[model samples]
Target: MTSRALLRFSSCESLNFPSTMQHAAVISCVFISSLLHTGQFALIETKETVWAAVGDQASLSCRLTEDKDVLQITWQKVLPNGEKNLATYTKKFGSRVSAGLEEKMDFQYESLQSCSMVIRKVMEEDEGCYRCLFNTYPNGALIGWTCLKLYVLPTELHGPFITISRSNSPPGSVVTCSATGRPVPMVTLTVLHQNLSFSHYNTSRVSNTNGTVTSTTTALLSALSSTQVECSVLVQTAAFRELLVTVPGLTDSSDGLDEDFESDDKDERWLVTVAMGLLVVFLCGAFGVLSMLWFKKKHQNR
Candidate 1:
């Protein structure tokens, strides 16, 4: 009975040994695979989009999440034609720029693990996407893409000039808001009075020689009982300026026109008064000189 019990226990141990070996083999393979991938691959951290004003400096950078055996780092500018190599950094050679790109851009920070470059004077031609490539061993090249956007901001924004005219047939006020800025600013018109309603139409844009744009938007005002309106001007996402103008009543259109004419009349009258006073001063000086000359001649004759 003891021999039979021992034999049964031995068979049970033999049956479980193969199962244990299979489990150990699987765990070992998983561990080795994780190690290989962790050593071979790297994560690149970078900004997706960077913005800079024209004639300003722009910085582009990238970093590695894990330590990589980076053989070389290449910075490429994406163009409409093709990808052009701008600069490169290596562990052995330090940093080097391409033949023609030395003055345009330079390496801000350089290392095997992280790198950055700055464009000294950004221009419209320099606006495009850039790529940072990590040439790593065994994993080939790990690439990170970033784009640079260039803009020409207006130095001085022109007036959001508001003008009102009478529409004879519709019997309402025709309001126009205009502004000038770089990159074509957006113009918005709002009527402040609750009883007033307006419909916008005919937005026109004109490009200037100095790389600026003039935008004019016209709206038809109906039931205009209010005396005020708002105008907003925006360039890209930035709020450039805002203006408030007086809206003459629909029935009071003639009043607004008359007021403008009256203002012009006042200006003309002031100019005429200045001219008349200057002429009188000249005539009085001439008369006094002639009388003095006549008296001197009589004295000399005596």
Candidate 2:
């Protein structure tokens, strides 16, 4: 073979080699450029917030400003001593970290772009700071933190039991009723006679160191007979309080017994009057018989 022909063949082989490697080199360069762009976009895009209510569901959101495909998103709770991973979202494994979260914390993941964590039923322990972390390919990682506070309110008030006692003497009697409640209670007492209004009293008492209050009221009755009395107690607090009303019929010591004794005395007096009348009638009949006999004997002697 000629030297020029041999050189030409070598040049053709070199040109073919360059042509074969061009497509692969272009693909590599494009892929690297895409990776760099994705990294930069991810670095600028990660931001999130966490919101929760006591005794309700809570959510942590990881929102991306960039429209690029996300690699992985993670949610974590910041405890006093350490951090606890709640949920994770990934593109390849689709949510590989969710199993760990479900097993440990029972948290559920929503989506890839969203590291949104759905906490089952929120509680006092669930309240704290949380972090949303995003791990992107070329861009390293991004972290967003949010602090949450939870408050729970009270439900209802319990009770106040009232008791009444009578102590003292006279035509009028003194009666007292006492009650207790959580917060300070307002007490009102009303006395009635045969459906007629007699007297009304109102008073309030507060608890000192202990969380209890007692109220008392006194009233004088007009007569020593059966009377209907109504007592009402009202308690007020921050959330709510309770109101209790009671009506009680009271009996006097002298009413029924005195009436019965008087009736018995009247019955004895009537019996004595009947006996005197019978004695008078019997004496009159005897005197009449004696006079008739004496007059008849005198006529016969004459």
Stretches of candidate 2 off by over 4 Å are 1-51, 96-111, 157-302
Kindly give the stretch of ten consecutive residues in candidate 1 with the minimal lDDT sum: 1-10
lDDT of each: 0.81, 0.57
Instruction: Assess candidate 2 and give its TM-score to the true structure.
Output: 0.35
Q: What is the lDDT of residue 120 in candidate 1?
A: 90
Q: Over the stretch 1-302, how does candidate 1's per-residue lDDT look in tens digits? A: 23434454444544544787856655555555555444433388888899998899999999888887899999999988989999998878888999988898897565688999899989988888898989998778888888998776667578788887778777777889999887788998887877665775668999999978899989887664557878889886544788998776765767667889999999999999999999999999999999999999999999
Give candidate 1's whole-model lDDT.
Answer: 0.81
Candidate 1 positional error at 224, Å: 5.4
List model 2 lDDT by residue over 1-302, tens digit each.
33434554444444434665865555555555566545543544333444544566665555656644557777778987887776766766665454544633533455555555566567777777887777866655666676655543323233434444444443344555556555445555566445545443445565645656666655654544456666555543233333343333234455545778999999999999999999999999999999999999999999
Which candidate wins on lDDT?
1
Report clashes for each candidate as comma-separated counts.
0, 1
